[model samples]
Target: MRPPKPTVAIISPALRKANNGNWQTAHRWSRFLRAGYDVTLASEWAGPTAGDLAPACLIALHARRSADAVARFADACPKRPLIVVLTGTDLYRDIRSDPAAQRSLELATYLVVLQDEGPFELSTAHRGKCRVIYQSAIACHSHAVDSEYFDVVLVGHMRPEKDPLTAMRSLALLPDDSRIRMTHVGGALDDEYLRAVQALQAQTWPLGERYSWLANLPHAETRRRIAGAKALVISSVMEGGANVIVEAITSGVPVLASRIPGNIGMLGRDYEGYFPPGDAAQLAELLQRASQDIGFLTRLRQQCAQRAPLFAPARERAEVIKLVADALRPT
Candidate 1:
């Protein structure tokens, strides 16, 4: 009889209902690992049951959010590998200050950061064990775009970290004749943000209804909207890496990203489609240019095209499988 495949457990703080980047990542990684191992996806892990063997490895999605699971796994299976994947908040906000997050980092056998610049945020000791694994998305056929409007999409929850208000605020700076229209695809997590979005949606801009808030569409529908848009905008103050950027690139859509380390790591430092984070005037100028300047828009598209190969599903799958295999190998 053939030997059974080892079990791997992936712990994500966000699950399917959350419909956020962490859930998407955990779901995708589970799919990838299934080819070589038995994978279980969960929001938390307290250790294996009384009669069951512990998982061969534990992959925890957020350092701070999944700290308890990581701690439990480490204490229960000291010889086994523990991989902690750092999210935006973990890298940018928590690991530096939060004790639980720092402890998770210390306990992990290997650490993963989604973008290249992630290692820079870590100390020298932790940096040695970290790897950069860029997230991937399968390519999709572009939707039939509306030529009447230069559509732009922002796909993330209405959270403070995402800095979505900058995208909304940019509309007031656009010229009266600008044809750019913004479509937001996310649920507002806070009452203040919900009210803000509602208020923005109610206003009529010179461009004739510039903003539309489609609260939390299904992933397929969101991708369809992204594929049809002229460009994608990510105005995050911090990001480990964004899945939406990968989706946009794979769907042949360009991106206008905030000038942040995580974004620069994904899009490259030379990419021209960057504006300073939370700067409405700069974002508005870029949006106006994207709508009116065909040359500039084309340049952005070409630049995004150059980066698309980095996010190929095949490449990511191979890298992910290798990481698991290495982790499972006897020390």
Candidate 2:
């Protein structure tokens, strides 16, 4: 008789209902592993019961939020492989101070990070076990962009960590003749943020009269919008590895990113499209230059194209498969 496939449990703090990066990652991974393993995904895993068969491996997303599940899985099956995937907050904030997050790192047999620079944040003791897995997005051909105005799309929720205000404030700083039109996507997480955006929209722009907040569209539609834009802006104060950045690059849309480690990690240290985080004036200048300077836009596109292969589906699938195979191998 043929042997049954080994069961692997994937614990993600966010679910389909959340419609966020964590859920997308979990869902994608489940599909990738389905051929070789029986994958089960949940917000938490209590482990197999006394009479039930334990999973051969556990993959948990978000070290801080999924710490309890990681601990439980390790306690329940000491010999079983446990993998913990780190997020932006985990690397930039949580692991530095939170005990639970730190413990998760120690307990995990292996650690996964979404981008190349993530390993630098790990302590020397845990660094050896870490691996980089860049996320993938299907390539979409560039759509015709509007010629009347230079559209710059920002695709992130209205959370403080995202620094949505930088984009908003930058619009006000643009010269009156500048044709840059800013489009902000993603759902508002709170009433205050919603009000702030609404307030910005109500103002008469000293620059070109174009600013719209199309709060939360379906993922497909968002990607379509991104593919059609002149450029994409990522203003996050922190990001483990933004799926949106991958989407933008795959769609042939150049990116203007904040000069933070996460963005730097994905775009490379020498990419010319970086502005200091929260510097509205600098962001405004870049927007103006991108709209007026074709050479600058071409450079950004060239750089993004060079990095595109790293985020290809085949590469991601191979890495994920290897990660699981290595974890399941007998010592």
Q: Best candidate, lDDT-wise?
A: 1
Where model 1 places Cα greater than 4 Å from the true spot, the runs are 205-208
Write the residue-wise lDDT of candidate 2 on 1-331 in tens digits: 9799999999999998777888889988998999999999999987678897989999999999999999999998999999999978888899999999999999999999998889999988788999999999899978945587898899988888899888888988888888888888888998988888878877875442567889988888989999999999998898999998999999999999999998888999999999999999999999999989999999999999999999898899999999999999999
Best by TM-score: 1
TM-score of each: 0.98, 0.97
Which residue pairs in candidate 1 have backbone atoms (N, alpha carbon, C) closer than 3 angstroms, thus clashing? none
Candidate 2, residue 50: how far the Cα is off, in Å: 5.8
- Report, for every candidate in turn, its global Cα lDDT versus the true structure: 0.93, 0.91
What is the Å distance of residue 250 in model 2 from its true position? 0.3
| Superposition-based RMSD of candidate 1 using all C-alpha atoms, in angstroms | 1.1
Where is the poorest 10-residue window by lDDT in model 2? 201-210
Lowest summed-lDDT stretch of 10 residues in model 1? 199-208
